[model samples]
Target chain A: MPLSTVLTLHATTDTTLPNTMGHLAHAAFLALLDAAAPEVAEAVHGKGENKPFAVSPLTVHREPCPVGREGDTRGASRTAGRGRSVHGSRFTVHDRAVALAAGQECRLRISFLDDALFRPFSEAILTLGQPTIRLGKAELLIARVTCVGSDEEPEARYETYEQLVNRLPCTVDRAPCTAYREPCDADAHSVHGSRSTVHEQLSFRFTSPTAFRVRMAGGERVNWPLPDPVRCVRSWVRRWNEFSGFPFEEDELCAKVEGGVGLARHDLRTRMLEFPRGRELGFVGEVDWHLTKHALADEPFLRQLHTLARFAFYCGTGIKTAMGMGTTVCRAP
Target chain B: MPLSTVLTLHATTDTTLPNTMGHLAHAAFLALLDAAAPEVAEAVHGKGENKPFAVSPLTVHREPCPVGREGDTRGASRTAGRGRSVHGSRFTVHDRAVALAAGQECRLRISFLDDALFRPFSEAILTLGQPTIRLGKAELLIARVTCVGSDEEPEARYETYEQLVNRLPCTVDRAPCTAYREPCDADAHSVHGSRSTVHEQLSFRFTSPTAFRVRMAGGERVNWPLPDPVRCVRSWVRRWNEFSGFPFEEDELCAKVEGGVGLARHDLRTRMLEFPRGRELGFVGEVDWHLTKHALADEPFLRQLHTLARFAFYCGTGIKTAMGMGTTVCRAP
Candidate 1:
């Protein structure tokens, strides 16, 4: 048979008791549980249609309320008049499989209840006592609840763990599961699928006083012994549908500077240096990655590509990051 | 004596009436004489200290102003009363060399004065008329004046050649001189003194997929391939100090892209390209020229440098103009 665990219903806040547990105490309890048991955290916090709790999974059993003994009415009346109860609810550990592992004791020894059960109760009396249970049983110990408390400290009043659990409208099984994991560190190698390839280049030009002329194919030309710095930047872009390997081959980008002296020439030189080598530079040195349409159909590949594009946009001009200095000038070609 | 030449000043605006020749008549007469007899465009529109009566150095002289009889009260009274100027103030060409160049029968005519002189005056007139004299003889010829007119018509005004020249203060002798020269057309060889040398270089980087590692003197380090396109631009700047050879030793004076990638890797590649010289992968080209410092310190050189710098800056950054892009980073270094 599956292990049955006790679910404790303890009153965290008691206005009647000075310096006792309060709302902060209850919040701390949840935070501690989350830190200690990530699995429990995941089970409680999992996103779904119904989110009951933000803790891990467990088969919870609530403790039963103690019955009044015969001829004990007078004692009960006296306690009831004082707004306190002597005989409180008691839970027993009957399932050996659910017992805590050795050396894995609860450090805070705190109690937890479904928020839905506690949220409706105005006042309650909480009694935390050692559980009466058999060793090696499949049961695990949890807190018990007693009588209802005064109106002045309504939230402090408590009900039996059984009563609280039974009052809940939804089954524990219906609660969404939380699968928490450790935070990712920056050093981990990024996982890039086969669909994407990253390309990078660095080019340089030198000034010569004696050169006659420099020429490139397709009528591109640069006169030697350049009078001033001439920087040319260009790129090509293609829509996702029209992406082809030869997209950048259709046109060339070109820029030239003439006039004035000194600062103007220097400005021209610097302008060329920062000009985007792709579309921004009139499609001068553009290359198409030629991303296949099939790749886009894959969700993960598409997601990764989008992520990379976002990263590039954030980086801007490339100098700020390890990406160096460059321009973004391509779509899938 | 240096050869003398005759100059002519033609009024671009019409001012052929009399009586309009008031206080300005004498000044205008002096201006015409200075422009014509010397055949100098001094004080010509947009030239030297441009004055009232101005002439174009390129304009050919046809007829000289007629010399009026001394104390010719009849014509003076007629001009003063009618407020119309016929012939403006004029002077004879006394220099024998200039007279002989005009030929025995040739009369030097003044034409083309800027239009600015007539705008302020209501009526413009030439007092003296048909005053002619033989060559090599100095004689007073024309007189003119201006007055307020009753008509409310808007006056036509424009910058006169004399006014333009006058506005440009003479600083050729006082301003610091430099040996700069403007760059000729692409086909023309740039002329430089013995002190000038030119430097240039060209470089390329393998940006496709494989060249992601940077090997330096310290160690081989893998670099994250840039996710964006990269471009390389080159620029040249002039240095002012005199040096025995090239001032390459002055690191600050050298225009360069630095810090993004370390120099060790760049230096190694440069050496490989220089040594045993053959084709090599990951090899880009570079050129450098050294010019005499004095040669770079001229207006033409400065102008060319400014133009080049502008081009470089534009191309490097892919910006259309210098206005919108943030402050330029190009400097003397």
Candidate 2:
């Protein structure tokens, strides 16, 4: 089972951190693992390939969120460690350098792709008396961690493929404020519609810039900054096969996906993320991946595609997930 | 020279027309040509392969533009048939069925790729007395046809590759409101920067939805809607080679464009145009195509690509230029 855990920290003093903080957030995650289990940390850090975990950039709010609260007052769930704390500030990286004043609250979300790494991460923070992470030159003290949603800030997410595949049709029993939100703090895929529903058309919102690596004419590799159905599904399937233990027929799956899925509608725009190598261009916004008339005949592939759409919530889309690109959300509309 | 000619027409009576009017616009163009030169019209209509002309849909405005006015009040240029007539109105096809009231003004733009076709089109419209075209059940009376700039409506456009490539760097003396606009009415590629300057990067604004026909996995044909630099340039090069009469090595040009040109920045969004076949999805907005590090060493290809970038203005990008899709405007930043 995978988990998306969020750590709420308070800045000790005024400091400014670079906008490209995803790289630093990953380092903080490893530091946490290193403190609990150095061996596991070594393996995770050394495996430059797809590690079992990913991290989001440090999201800061000038106005603080309730960090030391025990539980949400609404009693949404037992796992929601902190009560209904909504950080309504802009999560967008607006500047090259972001300023954090003293006592300002910030959040760092870590997603454990595999269960093997979750134990150490859970132990690392739980056992530590006073844990702090260095951001820029300031030491930010970890006040609390949340794994479930409060009523006001419903960010809790934890579900397996079985749970996703067998989930019931919803909307009647969901939170009233189920306004479309990016699962920034939790690992929830936020899947709508039930497993039994004839799921043909699905939409995805690329919360972060997402791009696909395409091999163009003459064997030149280039970045395709578009939400292509085949490429997006292929990227998700790669991770699913690697970690899920249920490997898919890559060639056949790709063929069906390529022929069946069509971009029925979209509202996408290109965005550039400044990476160390250079600027990486990608697209962010909603894309409606629709199954064509031919695809309706193939029932199994349709089920598989829909399942992968939910899985994309946990795995993200395209490459550079560790560096804060490809944060996607799926919905039925 | 390729010319972008816009005809302002007044509706004879109130009537409704379908939003997908590009096909009808093309037919009206052929009808006008048949009235003037049936033999030329026969060759053009028969050569369905790369008809020497393309057309935009009938753009309607409830509030009439000054149609019968002699010249645009701007007094911008001599060749301008009507002086500055700026259609500040939203040119978007808002609804599936658009209603045109009696005496409502509408504009139709036609691009003549080859000089051979421009003669018949020009003669057909200029020589006719009280030229009128039918839209749905309404006959639209041609009020004015402007090929040069008026003071207010700067829609007059006429440029050649030599003119674009040899034009000097501008901005010192230009229209105060040369605010990057989509050249909807004219065949102006709108190239900036002189050939002597190092034109490493250029930008394009796709006013109409543009899509590329790509061969996907297992030899499947799919539509990729984002503006990939190589694909856009290749699309332009195809039309350039077909009509420009100065053909370059296709494979070499594609290779250079693929390996050299990179999408550095963009602000694009997807929109759907309802087509008879189905809904055709493509993207609209701006893209900055920059030269890569390796491209700096290749001067000839660099110069060649910059030329194509300007040519992209007249030829458009991707498939279905004969329809109203792929209306592009180029600029320097």
**CAPRI band of model 2?**
incorrect
Tell me, by lDDT, which candidate is best.
2
Residue A260 lDDT in candidate 1: 8
Q: What does candidate 1 score on TM?
A: 0.16
Q: RMSD in angstroms, all models?
A: 32.8, 8.9
Candidate 2 retains true contacts at a fraction of 0.27
Candidate 1 chain B, which ten residues in sequence have the lowest lDDT sum? B265-274
How well does candidate 2 score on lDDT at residue A90? Answer: 36
For residues A71-99, write the lDDT of model 2, one tens digit per residue: 22222111122212112343544224566
Question: What tens digits encode model 1's per-residue C-alpha lDDT throughout A232-312?
Answer: 111111111122122222122111111100110000011111112210110112111212223223333333333323222
Window of ten residues with lowest summed lDDT in model 2 chain B: B178-187
